[model samples]
Target: MSPLLAADEPSNLPDLEILRAEVGSAWSAYQDTKYTRATRLIPGILADAQRAVRSYEGDAQLQAKALLAMAYQGAAMVLTKIGEADLAWMAADRGLGAAQESGDRVVTGSLFRSVAHCLLSNGRLTAARDLVTDSAGYLEDGLPDASPTYVSVYGTLFLVGAVAAARLDDRATVRAFLAEADAAAQRLGQDANHMWTAFGPTNAAIHRISAAMELGDVQVAADQGPRVDSSTLPLERRVRHTLEVARAYSAQNRTDEALALVLDAEELAPEQVRYHFISRHLVTAWVRQQKGKPSHQLAGVAQRLRIVG
Candidate 1:
């Protein structure tokens, strides 16, 4: 068992609200790119959530299970970010179990998305695509008058599926998945972070940029990636999209532009840039290609990323 899954006996059990707030805080830490803080908080949150599950019963028990699911999902995301793919899979699987027990369709769907993410991280592109599609289909049938949370998770699933399809170079499937996500965004009518999904039209557009990048349409990604104002999205989303745009620029040999974007992202979220594979990869390549000595800015960013002295 992962240390993250290990539970400690609490002297006093925290109520559902407390657990929810802790989970929310951990998520906020993650979005703010404070990965270390997020990881530190998660184990305790998981332990407390487990205690809640053991102590509560009836509806309270179900709610506790939901919190556990969210906690585990957060763990998975953090683990994935830190390049712990195996542990992430374990966390995601545990979250799925908890989500099922919670009997919350939205939570279940969200966990399904997390599981697909784990698959994607592990290079199981086909499995990830199939899982997202199947989960989206299952959720769609049950959501007659869907809540915002339901719509967000349902749509986000297709967005993830689009990414998986893009990686497979399946243009048709990618377009179909994006269209489904866009339709869901239109139904929701605005950008909302329901259940922490951050799903909306802007997010759909961001996914299109991602798909373009995955499909090796560097020009399209470079053109469209920068124009979309992702300011309305979460900090994490904004930083990630910025990195993607930087990648597009790099692919086009727009080294200066790419370096500038990388710098900008680093300023916004230093931890994210330091830990992100794209930023590290780009910096490493720049350092390797330098003639005698790299530029001041390049050296500075490279040093910060620990890729140079």
Candidate 2:
């Protein structure tokens, strides 16, 4: 088990609202690729949240516990990006348990998204797909009269499921899930972040790029790349978009373009890019394919990231 999953009783607990806001701030730092800062802030927040849940009752306890789940999910996201899949899944599992206790469909659904991501990152594609599929089915009946929160969660569930299906080469399942996600996105009308799911037309479009890559349609991934405006997305997502574009370029043997895009991603989110398996593998492969020594910039990043000696 991850030490992050260990419970700690906080010495001093802040106001519940304050703790909640701080957790949000920590997550924002995480999105900005301040991984160490976010990790430093998480343990105390998790401890405080645990205390709050224990000390409160009814709605207050539920809300506090939901925040705890979100914090754990944030930790999971960071852990996975840093190549800590086992620890990441441990955090995700903790988040899932907390979400279940919270009994908020939106929170539960969002954590399901996090868990599916962990599974996907660990290459458990089938499990990832089935988890999202089962959860989507469970959440379906709640969608009609649901708030934007539930709508975003529902759409993201399908989005992750679509990606998993695409990776599994189940093109039919991919299309079906993407269609369902698109329907939800259509209902929402525009891009919006709710429950941190970031599900909307724009996000669905981003998924299309990744899905194309998963389906071995590298050209399609490259072509669809320009459609996503990075400036419109959060820093985390912008970095992800850039990295995916880099991957598509790499697949097409456009090494220069790929390196440039990856450098852009590194600039946007150094911590995320520096530790990501894709970044390491791409750099290593790109360098090995070169006829001579890598260019200075490529060599610099590779050395800094320890992708090559």
Best by lDDT: 1
Candidate 2 lDDT over 1-309, as tens digits, reads 323433433555447789879788777877788899988888877777777777778988899889989989988988888888998999999999999999988888889999999999999999999998899988989977989888989998988888899989999999999898899999998888776666788888888898999899999999989778857667878788788888999898898999998888888788889987668889989778768888899898888788754
Query: Candidate 1, residues 97-180: lDDT per residue as tens digits?
Result: 999999998899999999999999999999999998789888978667999889999999998899999999999999999999
Q: Which stretches of candidate 1 lie over 4 Å from their true place?
A: 1-11
Clashing pairs in 1: none
User: What is the C-alpha local distance difference test score of each model?
Assistant: 0.91, 0.85
Global local distance difference test of model 1: 0.91
Best model number under TM-score: 1
**What RMSD does model 2 have?**
2.4
Candidate 2 global lDDT? 0.85
